[model samples]
Target: MEHINQVIEQLNLEASLTLEEIPQIDLYMDQVIQLFENKFTESKRNEDDKVLTKTMINNYAKGKLIFPIQNKKYSKEHLILMSLIYQLKGALSINDIKATLTGMNQKIIKEEIDLDSFYTSYLNLTRQNVEDFKVDLEDSVKDVNEEITGDKKGDSPYLKQVLMISSLVHMSNLYRRVAEKLVDEITVEKEEKRHK
Candidate 1:
């Protein structure tokens, strides 16, 4: 329980810069990398791990996962796009991310929405959902722990840990599936619109 609480505390302390926290001025590639590294320090597992790399950034631009840099300077919108890709890459495929970004770019290009507006809305919703997930995870962990403690069969600590991990993995898998479904839906919608 102490360990669980500590983990939760660490998670609660983990911070990502809000859309408003990102600078509006255009930044050079090195500056962009440094900014992401500072903001996402917790995400790196080791000192040697790169948070954002120049090669990855170049690939993202070339692949159209993010907007093209102008005069080797990335704008706030580019930062926002890269941030989203960084967060999603762990759970989503590059194709799915690209499709979603394409839809967003379409809206932005059409003047139906602005990048700042979209990013602000995304940040607000994501922050709320992250808070809710934290609460849910804490409650689930406590409930699992209590159940293990109350078991007369004398479950071992290993068993308890296994059960807790399994439950969390199941929940994570569900979220991943839902995200895939959403990507598919968005992609199809975009395709249909393009044809019309």
Candidate 2:
């Protein structure tokens, strides 16, 4: 129970930078890398894991996952996009991310929306989702405990941990599947329109 509480607490502390936390000035590539590294160090899975890298940034530019840099400096918009890409990479394919971001850039180019407006909306939803997730996790723990109450092994910490991990993985897989389907639909719609 203590371990479970600690996990929940850590989840609540998951790092995400607000718009105000990002540097307002354009940053050189090295500066951009350093900023992400410093901000997301705690989010890394291992001590050796890098939060961002120059090669990764360059590849994002080449793949059109991000807007082009100007005078070798990344603007705030670029940083926001990169941050989004970093977060989405675990749950989305690179091609899907490219398609989504490209569509967004087209909208901004056409004056349909501004970057800050979109990012603000995203941030709002992210914060709300995290809170919702924490509640859901607590509820899941209770449910799992009840389900295993009659079994001889029910009191085993290992059993609780296993069940919780299984439940969480199942839920995440469902969400990922739904997101992938939506991305596929978006890609197909774009292709069909281009052919018309």
Candidate 3:
């Protein structure tokens, strides 16, 4: 129960970097990797787990997930795109991510919105989503405890932990499925526009 509280606390503290926090100057691969590694240290599951690597960056470029670099240095826009990719890759396939980005880019252009403006709006939405998620998570834990309390098996601390983990995993799965559906819709929309 104590550990669960800690997990909730950590999630509440999770935040994406603001645009001002990013360097204005272009960054070489090593510097970019180091920046993400340092900033996302808390996100690592293990001591040796890397938040970002040169290989990943190269792959992203090769896959066209990001724009081409200039003179072997990545610009601020590249950093923002990479940050978005990093977040999306947790639940989306590479192809899905590519399509999603394409659709978003098209929409942004149509709306005459710059990347910085779009990202700022996205950050605000994310903050609100996180707050909503926190409330939902608290409710979920409370519900699980109530159900467990009525069952004889609830006496086992391990059972409580298992139930908690199961609930979280199911919630994550639900979100993932919804995201995939939205990506599919984006792909369809792009195809329709192209054919028109």
TM-score of each: 0.88, 0.93, 0.91
Best by TM-score: 2
Clashes in each model (backbone N, CA, C under 3 Å)? 0, 0, 0
- Between candidates 1 and 2, name the one with more favorable TM-score: 2
Q: Which residue segments of model 2 deviate by more than 4 Å?
A: 11-14
TM-score attained by model 3: 0.91
Alpha-carbon runs more than 4 Å astray in model 3: 10-13, 104-112
Query: Of the candidates shown, which would achieve the greatest lDDT relative to the real structure?
Result: 2
lDDT score of residue 106 within candidate 2? 70
Lowest-sum lDDT 10-residue window in model 3: 103-112
TM-score, prediction 1: 0.88
lDDT winner, 2 or 3: 2
Please, what are the lDDT tens digits per residue for candidate 1 over residues 105-140? 666557687777777777788778878977887898
How far out, in Å, is residue 62 in model 1? 1.5
Q: Rank the models by TM-score, top first.
A: 2, 3, 1
Question: Which candidate, 1 or 2, would have the higher lDDT against the true structure?
Answer: 2
